[model samples]
Target chain A: MESSSNRLFSARDLIGFAVLIAIIFVVLPIALDGFRLNLFGKYLTYAFVAVGLVLCWGMGGILSLGQGVFFGLGGYCMAMFLKLEASTPENTSIQSTPGIPDFMDWNQLTALPAWWEPFNSLFITLIAVILVPVVFAFIIGVAMFRRRVGGVYFAIITQAFAAILTILIIGQQGFTGGVNGITDLRTLKGWDIRSEEAKEILYFVNGGLLIVCLVIAQYVRKSKLGRLLIAMRDQEDRVRFSGYDVASFKIFIFCLGAAFAAVGGAMFTLQVGFMSPTLVGIVPSIEMVIFCAVGGRLSILGAVYGALLVNWAKTSLSESFPELWLLGLGGLFIAVVMVFPNGLAGVYAEHVEPRLMALLGKSKAAAPDSAANETPAE
Target chain B: MFSDYTMNELGAIFAMQGFAGLILFSVFVLMALGLAIIFGQMGVINMAHGEFMILGAYVTYLTSNLFADYLPSVFGLYFFVAMILAFIASGALGLFVEWVMIRHLYKRPLDTLLATWGLSLILQQVYRSVFGAREVGVSIPDWMMGSLPMTDMIEVPINGIFVMVLATGISLAVYFMMYRSSWGLQVRAISQNRMMADAVGINTAWTDRLTFGIGCGVAGVAGSAFTMIGSTGPTAGQLYIVDTFLVVVFGGAASLLGTIASAFSISQAQSIMEFFLSGSMAKVLTLLTVVGILMIRPQGLFTLKLRK
Candidate 1:
């Protein structure tokens, strides 16, 4: 019951965090050249989402399949800003409507649309990046959680949300850049973002923000509200009977998860320089869940590893043999759910950690005790 | 929006769109009925539902080819044979999946969703590999190719009528099987109280398998009928999965009447709105409405009374 309020970082947790930091911040920068490091940085952006999933789905047991919606919303918000800046009158001097985006010009729009007006301001766009998804998450969370509609039903509804958003984006091609997405992103507030230096800077910024998100997630996990979330997840009625506002907790964590995902989305657009409906759709949303599942949904650090490893595998496999990626991903989904419900983190905690402890001349009992202590509060 | 069209033109437009909506409704009903049975009865989120439908579409495509090449004289009669074969093929696959995957995750509904999603991905890949990535079209037999001239401006396609008839017949068959048979009682009994049904000598596992199979079989039939109105592709089923699930969910999961009512309303709304707005805006509005209503009424339009 008091597990949430335990030491914020056990020695094991500190070591894991340190190792994760070393990989993301130090080793990768040294080993990989510019392009690959930028790719890893993109993967780290997704890690922010995985960390949020670790809290929302792993601990709170509220599986939102539409995390991509939040991510996309965040990315688009930033992309809108970058796109507007890139589509300045001087930048598009030859177009019929010099101030408007090229896609809008192609679609025969004479002026910048009303919605695109606010995005011209960088401050507003930055605020909108986080606020848009958080608000959307709040509405969804409050509506569903308050009604106590959850489990597979919630999962399906969220998935439907992703589908709806994708369709809307694709259908509104004139405004959204359609299936091609918001491309030709060139600069951010006069800084030429297409430079290799900018890519490296964005990569570091993405990594730095991910680490910040990790700390925030760790704080939430060690807080009393985290305990309440676990308590509600495992036994909702019990928490309700105990006079706690179960819905409020669920809504908070869900919104928090959305905020984290939104940040990741913004970072994704920053590093990748594009935002599209493809990333904001049903397939990518579900794939995001797989990242959390593979990493060890229960472990925040594991989530970072999960995002890195899965994305790494996806890039390498798809690059070589695109046909095998889907098969491998499908097989991995089944294997993770059935064979390793605890995921990579679970495997490590159960098998590898104990062996490591023994080799360190420490008591093996401690490893099993920690594992048992983290049994989702059920 | 109505200012551009006079009364007669508006009437004609509404009538044409309404008929189109009815055809869409038939497709929705066909798709939703199977989902309602599987999701409501078995508590398994079969994300591969669309794939099952696509399997039927592929089966129909194969049967059409076979008739075209091997039995030209009976090409007109190939559709009926195709429908039956599609049902069998999809049902068999559903049964296999139930045994291998679904049964293991019955205790974890969320896990079932993920596992079945994985299953959907694998099935989609298989279809893509076997049938190629291109969408396939069945040759409309000579008899089903023309249109019925209801008026100068309101012509109806024979294929649409055929699909409507097929949908009605299958829906009636499903109604009979669910309400007027002993098997359906066992299914309902299991859905209501699995432990009690098991204690009362019901073959719960077998019933579950059969229910899943039947659901997939129905989806196969839906897919077969679908080829008349649209092209079939490896991922065709995915395009409609969300809409079908919405239909089932909006109708109240366990209620057949609710499913039909919801499907009718959604399809009609979509078709009618599509005529007035852009196709994407219409879809967005219709889905947004359904989702909004669902948020407010999560049990859906109708819910069965049961003790928790």
Candidate 2:
């Protein structure tokens, strides 16, 4: 009983969770103003995708370079809903088409397309945000995994999907708001999202949802399924011979990751007040993978911090020294892969966690299955 | 779409579109050859491949300027010199990248992808800094400027023809090098069984470097050809990277013939579709079909019948 309880949440794990929670819910809100907090909220949305990557890439050894597709889909779904609400006939009376989106009107679309009709309902839009990406991922996962296509092949294929989606979005401008994406999302069910108070509420809501996701991730990590994922990553043939349906597990995790990214996308639309093809393309998609890598793919908590740190750096560095930002980012990619393959989580496990244990007078034997000792050098 | 044109005009359009496709096919083949050599032979995905090609383009641009300024009498022949220089410059860089970054990550193919992508980013920034972030075009010599009047309605650009000829020559050369040369024999052996090749007295490490350098050299040559058709920019290479990758993957890895065939088919499909559909739609459709087909036949259009 004690072992099982410890497996679910070791003392160290609990401490890590508490610290992360405090940082997100307590410290960040106190330290920054509403505007900066909103910006951090935007960054935290990326953490959702990063956390999903931890499960898919880190644990399952499935590196999807197209998480942005799911993110974009989710954002678009939410954006479509908001755009529909904002495009009430009275609001869009100046346009030739008074009931449809302005972009659609510009493109000379007389009416809302049948597909866009469902997004009118918030409940339907919310559900579609998750379902669309999961369905897309399910199709991709099934197609690739069943054929036993994986590793670099899977990564490239996912990237192609990102490219395809981007082109489709940009090409079908009338329907998808073109390359500009669904923008000028003013409200959410008539609650002015652009206002300070609403942004603050959305941030806390985003933070709460993120905490729920982290706990769910932790539960999965401590489960037998998580052990199976690690084993499958290391030795696929052995796992297959052991009577497990490897493809199904891969499909499940990929879908879950897609779903997480979708939620992040929805939150992003709410916070950033727009969705654009820039967020759905190859560059952003690959950047999302780097976030997972930087966070230490093995740790969900690390993914959040990784997302925050990398994004913060990107925002500040680009704002100050645009020329140096790409160089720094490029260097970070090399350093993360070459020097610190385990990322912040690995570093913490190796350097910080052990020292913390020592400072607290705890025996090292108490945490035999710590992530650091088990991380096979890839 | 066909209803708009008479039969004679339709035939002319088809002929014109076919020629356009052939030019695109040349570009695809050139880019895919280098990528195929690297990915197929070494099992390394160099995302920086497009950047290498752009490096070749920048070299060509510089060479054109040099010839026009200093060697006015030999301006027409500067292209030949530029191609060779591009090969050397890009090849040398590939060799260095392999030594510094790729060598350590040989055991990790995915990590190689990330590292090379970083290399690509750095290379892009370097190009932006050096070239002022603007698209640079090379001046075409007088001999390469005219179009051949193939028909009343159809004319062939001399540069397009030149690029095609160059692509064909490079393809044949690569085919011979891969199939007939002793270095090619060592590369195939190493790719097939590294341990056996090493035990049989081959310098596997040096061979790997040479293979990578040659692959990148081929990309540089492709880039040299590219400057004839398009402008060179820091980010232009990225646009081609995905298409080039799809071409290589669609053609099975490890098969030069497959790469050529796949590139030809994809380029033709895309070019022909571009006439009837919007360019972006054509691209999306072409990519979708390729990806859909890839899903069904994961081994690609061709596969090596190797005994594992």
Candidate 3:
């Protein structure tokens, strides 16, 4: 039992987790005002996707560029429930179809669509928020990984899915709120979500959920399955020769990544008040990958910071110099791929952690060595 | 929907939509041919290929203005000059990008995708800054305007015919350059076995740069043709990038014949469906079908069987 506990959380990992918890649950909330905290909360939602990418892309070598689809699926699921709740006959009495969402009424839908029937219940919607994307990922994973389609091909195909989903969403605007997306989400279970206090509460809730996801990701990373993933990434044929069902592992990780992105998407809808086709497109999907890439794809904790830093940079930079932001982002993508493939975690392990260890005067050499060794020698 | 139209009217609509699909097919062929050469032969995913094409379009835009302002008498011939200039401009940039960015990433195809995506974003911004954010249209030569009358009800735009001709000419040229030329032989040799090709005294690096250049040059000409059908914007290239990638992949990445066949099928399917459904729905259905087919046949419609 002691060995298992140690395997799950080493001294170094515990320290990392504690720092992350303080930063998310304490530091940011104490330092920033409500508005800024809400913005950070939105950014944290993306960290969910980034963490999932660490498991799928960084560890499993499955570079899915269409994570936005899962994110959108999750968001839309939440949005559907919220829209349904907000469309109580009393609330939507102004519309011709009183109990249906305003967008549906406007689109001439006389009744709620049969497929949307399940989302009327929060319990089902919550389940669907995770289940829908996982199922989609499962289908894609079984189709591609089972056939041994991977690397650049997998990336391109996933991107194509993003495009297809975006087009489908936009084209079925009457059914999907069109380009405007599902809007005017008022309350969740009679709670006023638009209030400042509610916003702060949601921010905390998002942070808590993100921490939970990070722990789950870390647990996966520490397991024997994690070692197998690394081996498969490095040599698929050899792992297959060793009688491991490589496709099953790949599918499992992909589905888990989908679930993470879905949760983030649902949180985004709750906090941001709407979900749109824009979030489900190719561009946003690839940008999510960059968040993972910037974080150090291999590190779950780093994924959170990566999402925060890049998004904070984006919000501030694009606000000031819109054109320069694209140029800067473009440069970031190139530099990340070329100069620092391992990202922030790599830099930390290589340059910062060692000095800190020396400063602490702890002669426990194995910890720092293991941390350094984890950085791929590419 | 079919019951509304008489047989003769339906025939004319089919002809018109088929012609539209043919024009779309030409564009896909032009774009995918360049990508096939770069991605198929080189094994590098140049996400900035669309930007390279847009570079050609911008060059054409400049050339047209130059002719209309300084030498109105020779304005009719400016398009030919623009095509050559666009090819050189884009091809030179391709060569430079290959040397500076791509060569280092040859062993990492996925990294090349990200880097080229960055290159694309930078190029888009540069275009936005230089050309302004709004899309720019090239004024067509007088001879290329109006329509070519076919049957009593069927008339095709002259510019569409011009783009089709250009696409056909370029496709043939690419086929010859890739298959019949010694340079093509050297490229094939390298793609098959790089170390062995290098050992046999081939200048692999220079050949790679030149091959990348020619691919971009063809994309330049595609951009030149593109101006005939639609306006060019800074982000216009992005709108085509996904579709172009799908075309190349669907055709089997390495086979030029496969690219053409896939382009033809996809374009025809999309245009025909567009007549019946909303444009966006048609696009979604077509793409969904392609992706579904791809899932079933991951190697694509045609593949070069090479030993591991």
Cα error of candidate 3 at position A35, Å = 0.5
Kindly report which residue stretches of model 2 are placed more than 4 angstroms away from their true locations once superposed: A1-6, A363-367, A371-373, A376-378
Candidate 2 DockQ category?
medium
Instruction: List model 2 lDDT by residue over A32-88, tens digit each.
Output: 999899999999999999999999998988989999999999999999999999999
Candidate 1 — which residues are off by over 4 angstroms? A1-5, A366-369, A372-378
User: Candidate 1 vs candidate 2: which has greater lDDT?
Assistant: 2
CAPRI quality of model 1:
medium
Predicted structure 2, TM vs. truth: 0.98
Residue A208 lDDT, candidate 1, scale 0-100: 86
> Residue by residue across B1-308, what tens digits does model 3's lDDT show?
89999999999999999999999999999999899999989988999999999999999999999999999999999999999999999999999999899999888888889899999999999999999999999999999999989988999999999999999999999999989999999999999899999999999999999999999988888998899888999998898899999999999988899999999999999999999999999999999999999999988898988875
lDDT leaderboard ranking: 2, 3, 1
- Candidate 2 chain A worst ten-residue window by lDDT: A369-378
lDDT tens string, model 1, B1-308?
79999999999999999999999999999998899899977878888899999999999999999999999999999999999999999999999999998888888888888888888888888988999989999997999999999999899889999999998999899999998999999999999999999999999999999999999999999999898888988887778878988899999998999999999999999999999899999999999999999999999998999996
Looking at candidate 2, what is the lDDT of residue A261? Answer: 96
